[model samples]
Target: MNTSPTNSDSDTLRVLAQAIAKLILRFRFSRSRFLTLLDEELVLQAKNNDPQANNVTLSIRTGINRRYIPQLLSGEAMHSKPERLKMILEDLKWTSQKHYQSGKVPLKGSFNTFETICELRASGTLTYKAILEELMKQGKVKVAGNKVEIISNNSEQDNEHREFARNSVEKVFYTVEEIIQTEKN
Candidate 1:
């Protein structure tokens, strides 16, 4: 099965959102060597490219305030809302489809209530709950009553925990593969 991100419309939206984010960062830092006119042209291009795209939804996805959408679009604001931006990005590439498809195996712990976990499961990853469990185990996610939440708002730390969990998963998979190979021998 093709698991490419391009297969889903959400993927397009995700990419667009990310690109916009980069633009926001560039605009904020005032480091653009290009002329101000060029920067203005870029923002206008972005605005024109997706005027129909729900700005409010994008705000929700990016964790930016809906009211700020006008400001961001107007070139009055430069900084992206860091928290919401991370959530939306996470929603885009949070999990593999295979894990959700199985529907039997449990996740670690942290992914239980993640907004994207259920969607990932629907897309064929492990069940959302299973992913949540695994996330909790590694401290990447926190949960109460099946609703997974982020324990730390720190993006760097969250990324680190995710890496740790991925590594742990790989090690476990290797062990299982070894056992299977031994049995076959």
Candidate 2:
């Protein structure tokens, strides 16, 4: 019994130590990769039409310094205690592949759970009293609870709403422009 306990203790300690080492190595590599990605994003953004481009843009945009960049990219900074560099390289490769793989954005329709619940009620899925009872049972639509958290549409108006407003403004502006052009003629 004593010998078994000793072996178990040793095994537990070994597992814990391995987990800690792995976590440390992962953090070191993740931070380094994060810096590299930051630099690349900065360079790309600097080339784009954004007006804010300065010397510190390399550091500010990439969130990394030139001095650290070489150390990180070379894999020297991560230091091969074991599979640290390999893991980071694998992660970066996957990310690169994902970036290169182009696909059309999937179309999405309007989804409102609140509206669905109302429609279900109208269709006699349950009576209003039955719905209230279900809500009380679930604790989500709490009645007696000290704090009743209501699910509300807190999200801002969707793109469709913005598009409608934009089109309305454009139509008005174009009409005014046409009138001006006609008067000038």
Candidate 3:
């Protein structure tokens, strides 16, 4: 994997930071809360990238408190159940694309089942049952008598959730464009 940051990556980071700053300002979010949330996100990202990642590794990589890593992973910190489920859904989508033969796949008797995918992506932090429950709640997956069917990848979420995610992404792009124009001027 190329670890070097390209110009585009740097620009994206700048825009992401600006958007986060704007959101913080708009919401008047406390600095401690922001840092905690950021830490949780970083920890999860690290775990996803490296399945062997642990509290010590995450602390070293993210400068977060080692003590809180367990709490964050266990959903005790900020209730990250939704985020965990979303990550599982993303992994399922990717795995399905790469391994499954069709839109529907078997729940068992396959290496790329939903449970196995969750086990691989979550690195044991998230349980298959938990992810299944969340997916069921969102109507993203259905369990029949024996097989499981993926209704959606959780990409097209509810309107409110979708709009919130879209706005956050748009804010980053707008901020980046503004910055580029300012620099050119």
> What TM-score, over all chains together, does every model reach?
0.23, 0.19, 0.39
TM-score of 1: 0.23
Residue pairs in steric clash, candidate 2?
A: 38-62, 39-62
lDDT of 3: 0.71
* lDDT string, candidate 1, 70-134, tens digits: 65567774543344323432552333224443212222344532444455434464555565555
lDDT of 2: 0.43
Ranking by TM-score: 3, 1, 2
lDDT of 2 by residue, 67-103 (tens): 5544444345433233332332233234334543321
Can you write out model 3's per-residue Cα lDDT over 71-155, one digit (the tens) per residue? 7777575643345566666776676667775555456654878778777767668777787876787678888755567785454
**Candidate 1 vs candidate 2, TM-score winner:** 1
Model 1: residues >4 Å from true position, as ranges? 1-89, 92-117, 120-122, 153-185
Say which candidate scores most in TM-score.
Answer: 3
Scored against the true structure, residue 182 in model 1 reaches a CA lDDT of 80
Top lDDT hit? 3
Candidate 3 segments exceeding 4 Å error: 1-83, 153-157, 160-185
Prediction 3 TM-score vs. true: 0.39
Worst 10 residues of 1 by lDDT: 26-35
